[model samples]
Each structure stands twice: as structure tokens, then as C-alpha cells.
Target: MPFTPFHMGAGLAAKALAGRHFSVLTFGIAQLAMDIEPLVGMLRDAPVLHGPTHTYLGAVPIACVTAALAPWLCRPLLRRWNQEVRHYRMPWLQESERWSPQVVLASALAGTFSHVLLDSVMHLDIRPWAPWSDTNGLYATISLSALHLLCMAGMAGGALGWVALQWLRSRRAAQRQRHNP
Candidate 1:
């Protein structure tokens, strides 16, 4: 699942559920960070695709690093996105794009942890409890098709939920404006 968009389904779901408490952009960065080891392995044609970085223990450092750097990396991108939204007159997206440190850290942790958990069920080489143990007890917990379908379902549900939330917020704002003005 290296560089796969499927991993983002979980992030989307988290964003929908947690709302302002989760940073989807930071989550995305963490997902990419988690895959770096596998990318390196693929580039070198190494026998083991999932190594230390694919484990639960490995996720901590990556998550922390991602959290630390995400604010710096995502702010400019978000500003650009907001500019585009403003240009297009997308009032539904006009809300502030600022992310707090706590949200960044939480999102990063969620991203890396979820990546490992998802990969654990699909990949044979993912030793989630490495160092203490090399057992891959989670491998093939469900069929590959099932896993893919689950991810797709999450993506769909999360997207719809987020859209619905935005619509409700906009409606409420319109109502308030009509009453006040």
C-alpha cells in the first residue's frame, strides 16, 4: 500500500468525525511519511518491502516528526487553497484554515497508527509488534477485496458526512444573517 490513496480514507473519516480537532493535511503528510521506508525499498529493489517503519514502534518517531513539521508545511498550502476557494466564491469553504498544535499532533498520530493497522491486515511482512516480537498475527485477517471495499466505503461515507456538515453550517450562518440583518 505504499503511496496508496486508500490510506487517506481513514484520514478523511477522522476529519469528518473530529471536525476542527483533526488536521487532514497533517494526516496526509504522516501517511506519506509512513511510506518512505517502503518507497526506499522499492527504489533499491529490496526483498523486504515493509521494514521497521511499518511497525507500531516505528510509527512514533515518524508521527512526532510529521507533527512537528506539518504546521510549517501545511500552512502555505492551505493559504493557497483558501485563496482558490475565495476566488471561486466558495462560501462553504471560507472558514479559517488554521490548525492548532494539539490537532496537528493528534492527526499525525492517527495517520501513522492507522497506516500500520491497515497494512497489518493486508501485508505479510508487517511486524506491528517488532523488536519485542516479529509475529504478524494480523496478516490476512480479512480478504484483500474486503479491505479495499472497506477503504472505499470509508472514503465515500466520510466525504458525504463532511459535505453534509458544511452544508448545515452554511445554512445556519445564512439563517443567523437573515435574522440579524
Candidate 2:
């Protein structure tokens, strides 16, 4: 599913579960990186659409590049969103929170690897191991409905978890302010 939101659902879950350890922006960049090969192939009508970029061998380097460059592009957007998400923002993070290198690397790797896994399930042409072997036994192992449901579940669960965490933080802040003020 190139350019689809299905990939984002996993990214959202990563952000919710990993919190500061994961960068959603970097994850998105990695997801786009994973699909770039196929997107170009489709545009040019190339014979091999999935290509090497969909393989594990390709994901490592792509993830690294995304990790290195994505933060620079995403930091500004994150800062803007951070400012807007007042309810979710930590008092100490007011205009100071930025995506660290560690967070960017981790999230990019997670996103690229997950993209390979998700695509491997649906695309018969995706040889995740590639060069070593050209077999894809994982193709259509599960129904499309099941895969879509899993993505949707991730989105719902991630949203709930994020909201809950923010609410708890806000509540704690309120309690502290009451006692201190």
C-alpha cells in the first residue's frame, strides 16, 4: 500500500508505546523511504516494482539515511505541533523538546523494518532477504482484512494510550500546582 495510512498506524503505535524513545516524524520518513522505490517504479512502469529497497538489506541503509536527515526536517514541524498540543505537553518541555539523534535512529529503523514486514505479507515480489534468497513464503499468509484490521487496531490503541498518558500527566500537574500554589 504505497502512500497509504496503514503504515502510519504502526508509527502511531510506536510513538504511543515508546514515548520519548520514538520519533513519529522519523518513522514517517522511513515509511516513505521504503515506498519510494515502488512509487518510482510505478511511475516509470518498471518491471520490478518492489526492487531491492523492499528488502532487509536495503532497509538498513535507508533507515540510516532517514535517521540522519529526517530529524532536521521534522524538528520544526514537531516544535509547531508541540506548541499546539498544550494538553499533551509537559510543563518542562515548553519549546525545549526536540527529537534527539537516538530517538530518530530508533524510530527510523522501526519504521523501515516494519514496512518490510508489512509489505512482505502482501507482495509476492518482496524477497525480504533478497541477494541471499529470492523466495517469499510470507505472501498472503493472512487475509487482507486481517492485516487492515491490525493496522486499524494499532491506530485505535495508540490514540487511546496517548490520550491516557497526556491526561495522567495533566492531572499530576494539576495536583502539584494545587499543593504548591
Candidate 3:
């Protein structure tokens, strides 16, 4: 993807599918973490723009670091967002002081791995299994147009599913309020 939003499609899909079991914030952090090496190389005009960080082997450490740090980093932001966004109170953000280790690990791993696979599909320079092989057979296997569409489709599907889930929750809340009153 050009930046990282293309990767967010999958993260959002994870959120919609797994609900509280998936932490989209941690997943997003991992996406940004994995791209740091490429960004540094781009700024320095290095010979290898993708570098080792773009590989599966390199992503492991990055994902681990991101998973460990994301909770603390996200806490204050989530608190502030919860305060500001009164109508859409985020359950996860309602209190970011705590998080499930399993959720964070799952999200971070998913994020990093997906990022490598997605980039490998488009970037000819990406050797995801480097040191073992330099060839990127996955590259250009599908058209760029198709890849973009796939990412967009994931985003659209996630958005729709989230909206439906939210609507159902709200409706149930309203029904409970009416019955109680």
C-alpha cells in the first residue's frame, strides 16, 4: 500500500469479526511499526528501500515490540477519545488502563504478517523470505488494480459489519430502557 490505510482494512475486519477479542489499535500500531524501516530508508535514500523489516523474519521483533508498547501508548489517547466521543463510547477506550494480552498479541501478529504479505504482492523489491530466497514470485501475480480493490472491499465490509453490530447493540439498549421504564 502507499502508506498504511490499505492495511487498516484488514485490521478493521478483525475488529468486526472478533469484536472484543481483537484490538484494532494495537494492530494499527504494528502496521506503523513494520513500516518504520522502509520510511527510514526512503528518507536516507538507501540502496534497499524495503530492507529486512519488510521480511517475515524482521516483522516478528517489530510486532512483539509494538504489542508490548501499544497499550500504554494508547491509554491516554483512548481516555481522551472516550471523553470527547460521548455518543459512540468505545468499550475498549472506556478504560484503556487494562487490556487482554491475548488480544494484543493476536492483533499485532495479524497486523505485521498481513502487512508483509500485502506489500510483497506489489513491491517487486520485497523478499519476504529473504536469506532463504531473493525471489518474489508473489509479485505481480495479481494486478495492482485488483489489490487495491481487495483492500477497499475489506474496508467496506468491515464498516458495514461494524455499523450493523452497533445498531443492534443500540436497539437492544433502547428496548431494555423501555422495559425498565
Q: How many clashes in each structure?
A: 0, 0, 0
Question: After superposition on all CA atoms, how large is the RMSD of candidate 1?
Answer: 1.4
- Look at candidate 1 and tell me the lDDT of residue 42: 89
Q: How close is candidate 2 to the true structure, as a TM-score?
A: 0.88
Better of 1 and 3 by TM-score: 1
- Give the clashing residue pairs of candidate 2, or none: none
Off by over 4 Å in 2: 87-96, 177-181
- Write down the lDDT of every candidate, Cα atoms only: 0.89, 0.83, 0.82
What tens-digit string does per-residue lDDT give for candidate 2 at 24-62? 778989999889899999999888889889988899999
Q: Quickly count the clashes in candidate 3.
A: 0
Pick by TM-score: which candidate is best? Answer: 1
Each model's TM-score? 0.94, 0.88, 0.86
Top lDDT model? 1
Error of 1 at 178 (Å): 3.0
Candidate 2 RMSD computed on C-alpha atoms after optimal superposition onto the true structure: 2.7
The lowest-lDDT stretch of 10 consecutive residues in candidate 2 is 88-97
Candidate 3 local lDDT, 1-181, one digit each (tens): 2366888889888777886677778988998988887788888887877878888888888889988998998888777767865657644224344578887888899999999999999898899998798988899899988988898888889878866776677678889999999
